[model samples]
Target chain A: MTTVPVRPPLVRSSDRIIAGVCAGLAEHLGWPVRMVRIGMAVAALAGGAGLVFYGWLWIMVPTADESAKRNARRPASPIAPAVSIAPAVSMPPNQSAAVGPSLWSDAYSPGYPSGPVAPPLGGPAAAGPVGYSSAANPAPSGPYVAGAPSQAEGTAAVPGTGAWFRVRNMRYGKEILLGAGLLLVAAILIARLLGVEVPLGTLIPAAAILGGAAIAWMQLDETRRAGLVDKTKADQAGGWARLAAGLALVVAGVLVMVSGSGSWEQTWLALLASVAVLGGVALVLLPWGLKFWRDLETERAGRVRETERAEIAAHLHDSVLQTLALIQRRAANEHDVVRLARAQERELRGWLFRDPARDAGQLSDRIKAAAAEVEDGLGNAVDVVSVGDTAMTDRHEALVQASREAMLNASRHGGGPVSVYLEVSDGGAEVFVKDRGSGFELHTVPADRLGVRESIIGRMKRHGGSAEINSSPDGTEVRLKLPAAAEDNGEGKS
Target chain B: MSTPALDGTAGDPGRTVRVVIVDDHAIFRSGLKADLDPRIEVVGEAGTVEQAIEVIGRTRPEVVLLDVHLPGGLGGGGREVIAGSAALRGTTKFLALSVSDAAEDVVAVIRAGARGYVTKTISGAEITDAVYRVAGGDAVFSPRLAGFVLDAFGTAPADIADDELDKLSARELEVMRLIARGYSYKEVAKELFISIKTVETHVSAVLRKLQLSSRHELTKWAAERRLL
Candidate 1:
């Protein structure tokens, strides 16, 4: 008895067809499999109930191994009955010990067990209380005469125990109601078309009322299902309900107008009234519906954009900015410094403006190229040293341009061996262009001389960075700092 | 490169002003050396801060033509040369020469004890006369640079109170400027020689202190305060 309570009903593995419902049930109940199949076929022929019941049982019942697996996974609830009905007749030795306490409890318990009482009837009557109580009490429990009295008494009280209400609250309740309503409407329509004088006025109104009631009930059910305590979500769902109600009203109005038979003027008047009602409802609700939909769309789009921005920011922070900072700190000479600056600029520009992605070639190679260019033009020795790698290829062009200008300044003005150092770090990159020549005054450069102004300072400014020229009689060192990330557009001026 | 002949017609070697060209680039040095009038004698040249100090100290020239931004120091550039070679402040007049025309650069070297600041674009004759004037103990700034020196060292009252900026530490202020300028946390850390985590901490502290929400707001605040 305890074993039966623990295990769910199992489908027989050695089945004929359609999941072996009749066979599995016959074996479980100790009935002849042929007799059960013949009864099922007779019920199915009478209507579709037996087929539907078989399909439902096929889906609900697990195989022996599956039942065992489910039992192992599921913990028994304290309120569940200790004795199961099947084992009482099938396995007698275990029955008495398990059945004793459960039989006593069943006789006294207020709420009768609903699970084991409904499977015997092979039609729509399975859901009906009359069939459940009558069939469950009389036949199977007869073998255990002592236990039969308590079992029969327990099942007898089940119908009045609000069992139907419990069933109605199940997740599929709305679907079942919708299917029934549609079937009812189809049946009525078919009956009318077959020349039966059906009352359209009452029937159509009744259908509309039923649909509206179902929608309202479903909305409330869904609200409870979602566990949304907040009013806003409930209100949103209510908006949907209102929209449904408006549609149902329009449908009801059309049905009434179609079913009416009167003078031409009277019919025209009725049509006008129906149209005005629909227009009024549409006028009142359409803007609100559109606004609600638009708000939801904008909110979703905003969330997506924000997430994308955060992702981009995190990527840049980890890779590009870090490398640029390192480069800024370690760069050794004008050429290498310029190259790093260029690379940094390009990276920033690309990031801010959403330019096409570029391959971040080796930082060392870029520095070398910058050094080579400077060395060629200035006829000066430039040493390049760089450490680390970064995949930031945004504003490199502007940085490189500024760096070239700084190098040009060094070669043209400072006039000696220039050393270019490239330092990349976590935050930004710095390029130091050092010249072993005379340093001059920054403020003394003529306004018309745009090399330092436009090429170095202006370019850096445009790229959202700064250029610092530290010059003295000892030597001039131009330090270019390019941040890893920058705003897309420059602020008017700094 | 062969050194060009200094014009002998200007003055005798003994009576000429002994000047040392302290530029880092050799080509410019040689060109300046060749172009200088005979009155201003090119005695020595040095590329970096250490070399500049050593060369200027050894020659003890009347005037040292200093490049504003010299390398080979602890990132101090030309200012370090002036600060390091403080011993020759009165004896040898230091005239700064560079391509930068930023007022901050001009003021920095001047504050470091340079006699004058001049851009490298000056004609060779003008530089020679400027060197002569500097050597003679007269301040010799380029025409445009004179305004920068005055503005930097001016006695005018500040347009805005410093109280707001005084709320932050130097490091915090540095971080704030970078953040306000749209530098990422990592970039700020690199610029300040700190960790990204530290940069984040500083940024948070700045935002908290300023009662601002984000970097965007901070930038707007800084711009409004003219801190950028």
Candidate 2:
């Protein structure tokens, strides 16, 4: 009933700053990873839900591609676990489990456990196939977890019970400070619940101190992850403004908490007033903020589509438009006339429709490279369209060499656009080089001028191929043909 | 918007063709009109989407020299104009024009019901010939467009998509490849030992097959290439 079987695996990513719990979550939820991180930080600091949740994920979630392969190899694991251990994890097992977040459960529920313990079953609700959701927490038990999927068995394997208590990576300083603050938060909350006379002023600033500490802790985590410690200036919060503000907020919170009982009425009034003002400000700036981000995204999308045309438009001004201005000033020479037309053609073809990726295979690539050489030095543009190709063969030499000569001659005499079309099939390979120059009679060309013509024709003839030259006032087409390969010829004889 | 004065070329072959120029460049549009064969009358001109659609709808010219890129109405370009002129598809034909043999925009316009496209680098006489061909119920496929079409349809008839209309006849494949290899209709005819008209028919049939395919290999090929 669900597309759960088709969904991507719920794996923790290596691209992480903290445990990658929120980052992986953000990807699946289509929320900004930053927002998810902040939300988790808040969740962790305020109630310790996020910290427990993240540690549980860190132990349960596989690190990357390695775990996915392991999951694929374990056949029949999901079924036995579903039958034997389904009831173990499904706390308060009921029909409600089947109904809520069905898609979410489907992805995670089916995963086989990484540990030596028999793979844990999904919630009892998902019957036909295991549907695992983050909500499907395994009943806490001994010997169920091996080390996290990241570490090998021989390494310092994390014991199952202590997995939630992180001791490695020695973030000793911040860890102690945050641990004490969380203890203080728990103490305050417990005292209030026990009717231990905790005042509203103490509670408010106490919460502030913990929140500020959490924000700073996360920022420090990001910095250390970036490997910018001690060298790169504090820049994430716009050059030390954020870190200082965070530290200052923590200090101010401490001071306010120590100064002791302010009027409860005054604190409530100030809190409501600040809430209203910030709400009004957010409402006022919301449209502009949305527009700013939207405009940035729209510009990024347009940049790709408009790049070719924009380059052409920019070059049209740089070359062709400037050439017209030069032509007007020069009152004309042959060079200027030809230059103007060439510039225009360059502006049209070079800037506009030329896709360098158009060429494929050895023959087309070599022929195009030859054309590029002529165009770069002599300034004649060639358009090449290739249909099919074969692997490189000895027969390629006559075809490529003849095509190059035809191209050079076409540029020299044709003095206009040249086009080459290459087609290779089982029968044979053929290349057509057509030039838009006033045609020449092949025989009328004197012997001395016949070098290129004789070379093209004679080279093809020598290689068991043939060349045809058709010239007219309109254009000239050099037809070069290579017979099919030796294997095909041998087959015909047999 | 503008409509240029036309000097009747009654002596020229066949009837005079009425065409609307829809390029955003005023200079190129004017120069093209000025240099075009006398047999083609410049019926109207426009530089943006609204004007092109308005001009085309008002004049209902026999052929529209539609620019593949435009500056208005969500930047749909020539495809947008062709889409706007959907009602006039029977009466008016679209001949796409662009600076290069830009495959996507040309394919977009063609898929949006344009007959075919020619690059701006073509000779004035050739453009006139293309316009005449469009007006006479023929499509213009430049060598570049032919190359693109050939590539788009080159994959074997996928047994995966069983639509009969998506298949091209052997004659059409031969015609398409020849055209892609820069063979003019006459040359292709001579090479294949068929009449020039038969080559035209095969070319038209290839375009029709591509247009008729709602979902198939050709559509998938073009979809993968959809900067269109």
Candidate 3:
């Protein structure tokens, strides 16, 4: 039996300190906030590798509201934001902050601080978030304010813009080498504080290993649509494997930091070896990285294409469209000339205004394509409109054919432009072919008119559909109705 | 602004109707203006949303032939031009003219305050008559516009122009259905056995309902924003 996952999504908590790195990590790993904090502090004191990891997580881990937005089905109750804190333990950091008295004080806080902190790396981190979260949120067991930052504070961050989803991937990245200068400063400051001669050679390898682990750590959570219920598996072995690989990197990094020597050549080799290890990790994540890159490239290409299209439109407006206006003005008294120019103008406008990638299979496209054929052959202008669309049914061909015939009948008899209105929904698809022609009596039409009877009515009836004709002196409208596919009804039940 | 060809006084049945043509293509605008009825005057012309607003403000034309897609004002196009002319809305009506039947674009403009929508393929005389009717403060529904009103209000989901925005009255539905069936306004009046003026009032009322309640409008506005 499948059970709902109670585990919180790995998002940086709304309540946080510094950048909420430790709090988010503690939250995801099910450890006391203080323990993760101490681990980070010790790592920081050792070689400043922790700050690089912290900085990376700060940039990568989405804040609480973003997490809530991504996995709407995580819970409606806002419980997912309650990252790390037990009623009996580690909330002393929050207690010390003196903000809102408890988690319940915040409007979106779904969990009352209770139960054990849970298993895994339990203790030492949850310290600083209590301070900043007090500004954005309110600390548990502190005086609550009526109007704190709350949800807005967490969601206010502007995500990166421009070529956000690129399609081109660099299998071997340039190695941005972020935080090297900061790593040096942090190392020197800590080395002096601890009164130990810091071995500068080992710093590079430790930083590389830590950076590599953080790179893999960023992929822990899945990104989904803004507002949809996601009910995927509670946990995947892949996630565990990544997490295990990350911890091994941390252990190996610390060991190298402890044992690394001061020789320049050996330090260079260690750096290369650590990079090789990272390359192996990157190889494991090649597919995911490739897809991510492709999205960014695709978005960038779409933007460039849009600019090019606008340029083409501007050029066309100056040339061909200007010429058409002359034709239109000169042909003002000529009905056919005016119609032809207007038709050409419409074609140009459609090309310029059509969406870059309109789905050809949509009912509107089908309706317009059929209408165009009639316009070209019969010299009758047709207005096609489709309001909403649905999945194509087995009866779709019958529906389109009947509509085409109706258009033909209207354009031929009416000697005027016809209007085709299509509405496709779960219930079914309905097409209305309206013509500005004089009335017709269905019975009086004489059975010799096989165009209406055999082509439209008969076709529809054979395909489990129906057709009705509404005729009056002003005009006539042929209505066609096709039921949605039989396969969809059962699928819709759940 | 173009001067009226024939100097006719206002309030006369045969008087000239001042109009604004707000289309992106200057060629199409001139073509349409050239083909219009002699009784209808092209008082103003604009090829973009900003220009439309400025020209409409300066000329105060009786009816504006608005294009649904144009080059300015947040890509709202005709909708934005109409929104920018909120002050002139009572005196100046909008009749949306589009080359395509993109439902969202048509519905968005209608919700923003277009009195009616007609495809660009409409004849010059029909557009001329439409202007005169709109000038007389009538909602001119081309057959396709009526069909759009029916489908959008009749049976789409909440996200796509369903009942939450506004539900049409039975009388309005009958009127729209008849129009969709290609009945002229006079014919619809006769079929419903009501006065022509009353029919106009009902059509205008349906438009008001589409963008009436702030509550109903918010959902639709949010949906439109999301789509864009």
Candidate 4:
């Protein structure tokens, strides 16, 4: 059987006259609604403080609608995975027995119906239930069917009870501490007015303990949350809470040091004592803060390295690995292998060192460079004549490589004088490698030859352009053209 | 009834089909010339698109064996030669010869008013037959390249949305279709029976109406819409 998820406590909109506070408390504490009402009435008869408490609860406890809205607005945490619920089959039969008297007593009452056992507090299971129940019930009345708090309501009630030790619970903790401190101070002032003496030493230590506890609680929460020690709600501490707690600690430390001193004349000693006390408290807190800082730095560096590694892997897969696979399939002889190796080397070197982002140099300059390289390598006399200076930075490498291949083929096969012509137009850039050589029939070109196929034609096609080879007994000409813009139209014919 | 020989080749002078070979490759041209039957006389030859236009204009060959990718003709290839020599369109037929069988290459040349396209891999006898078929005013293409022509030109041009064509006037629309199908300005003028200057004005108007930058883009746009 599927386990029913526990839901958060929310004020019942349907069950209350003034406010849903009594119904919400009754549901959350598992006490009968009638019993909670009787208790509240008795407290109200004794003094009007119960009414004030009820008023505070009404304001603090969100209505069902408000809780639902809050749950919807909360952003999903990137680092936190969705909490998973454990099956109810493994749950101990007496699990409800461990719940405190505040709510557990109602579970075992002879007259009471056996309700669903409340989820174990402050565990991953508790977090799971709140989120799950909200998702399971699209309407507010669905939670009432189960006689349990709605998912949003459960999350709302966590800070007041189940999640009291959680860092996020401190939002309400500060108010409670402030209220208690105010009551204590009022009691002392009233006693003094009634002619009773209040000792300064006793008051100072109490204030110190309260101040130190607040500061220490905040510091410990920061460290524990930073370490993700319990993995229970990693809620961030509010900026104001930290600031207020820090101020309280400083004030309490100074006051205690000054009051404990016997003479006002020894001002330096008292000041030094306050500083020493503050230093001791800070020393106790430093290790956790230091660990958090170091962990954050290491995590950031690791993420950067991971991103860089992924980029490199993608680039290699797209280019080098593909070429290697093709080479393995097509290599027939030593000559074919050598040609493939040279091509691979050129491609690898370009990928490693060429700045693709930089603007491609002039078309004329590229042609000249290609021609000069061919002449120097092959000892061929090449005359280069360039007419335009169009820059094609995007496909610059492809065009240059194609032109270089054309030049290499000419120098290798052509008879005598070779001429390279470069022209740039609005449509595209064109480079012509013309040689006065005995031209061979295109169809007669052996399949083993990689010079014309892979080097010239394939390069241009890869760059979204075309190559034209025209050869006759008069001379051979290779016209390499690159389109001005590369528009990928989803046809992989290239 | 014997006709005067066009190039003074011996044997069956009266029955000879005078032809010009317009390929940039000299060795291929020589091989093709040596392989052709004596009945097919070689009248003139040119290497570049400009030279092809000049020679074919002067020779007035019955068939021109044109290479699709010739340089030096206003940045256009074999299409430019057909465009430049518009007056000879009626008397002379063009049969494109190229190494590429790519659909774009086949479609571009055919749309430019070539009578046929044959890859260089075709046997000499097959090329000879294609030339004769083109000279007879019947369209011809290698078996593989025929699909490209059918896909491009055989379809009804009405596949494009009405809104894309609504802005263009009748004359502008006609010019746009031809130009987008890869015909140069001169060829479009010749085909439409308008002057080249008039074709230019209509083309620019169409370009403005359709917001196309160039003929290359226009061809791609038209091809994408299956209007060609």
| Predicted structure with the largest TM-score when compared to the true one | 2
Candidate 1 lands at a TM-score of 0.24
What is candidate 2's CA lDDT for residue A136? Answer: 17
Encode model 4's per-residue lDDT on A199-314: one tens digit a residue. Answer: 86657666766676676676665544333222233233453466567676666555556566545556556667867987998899899889998998687565445434433443
Docking class of 1: incorrect
In order, candidate lDDTs are 0.55, 0.63, 0.63, 0.58
Over the stretch A263-335, how does candidate 1's per-residue lDDT look in tens digits? 5676677767877997999999999999997997686565445434433433343224433443454466546
Write one digit per residue (lDDT tens) for candidate 3, span A180-298: 64667687879879998875567665765776577565433332211122334533455566677766677566656755654557656776787699899999999999999899668
Evaluate model 1 with DockQ and give the value. 0.02
lDDT of 2 by residue, A1-494 (tens): 68554544566777699767777777766678889899988989978988988897787667667577654533422232222222233222242244334322332233322212211221111111111111012221001121111221212122321321332233245556666877987898899899898776777777778777776776765444332112244345442665776776776576567555556665566556766986899999999999997996686455433433333332333334434544454555655454445444534444344444543445665676566555544556666776555655667867888888888888788876677777665567788888768989888888886555567988898888999998877578898998886675423210
TM-score, every prediction:
0.24, 0.54, 0.51, 0.27
* TM-score between candidate 1 chain A and the true chain A: 0.27
Question: In terms of DockQ, which candidate is strongest?
Answer: 2
Tens-digit per-residue lDDT, B1-228, candidate 2: 000001111112488888899999999999999879887889999999999999999999998998899999778998899899888989999988886444566666788888877777667767777777777676677777776676666533434355556665667777776676556777678779998777777877777766766656566665454221
* Global Cα lDDT for candidate 3: 0.63
iRMSD (Å), candidate 4: 19.8
**Model 4, span B1-228: residue lDDT tens:** 000001111122346799999999999999899877777989999999879988998999999998988889787889899889899878998888886544566666766777666766456655666666556555542333322322322222333454443245566546544432223344457668987557655543432333222335436634543210
Q: What residue runs in model 1 are displaced by over 4 Å at the alpha carbon?
A: A1-494, B1-14, B150-228
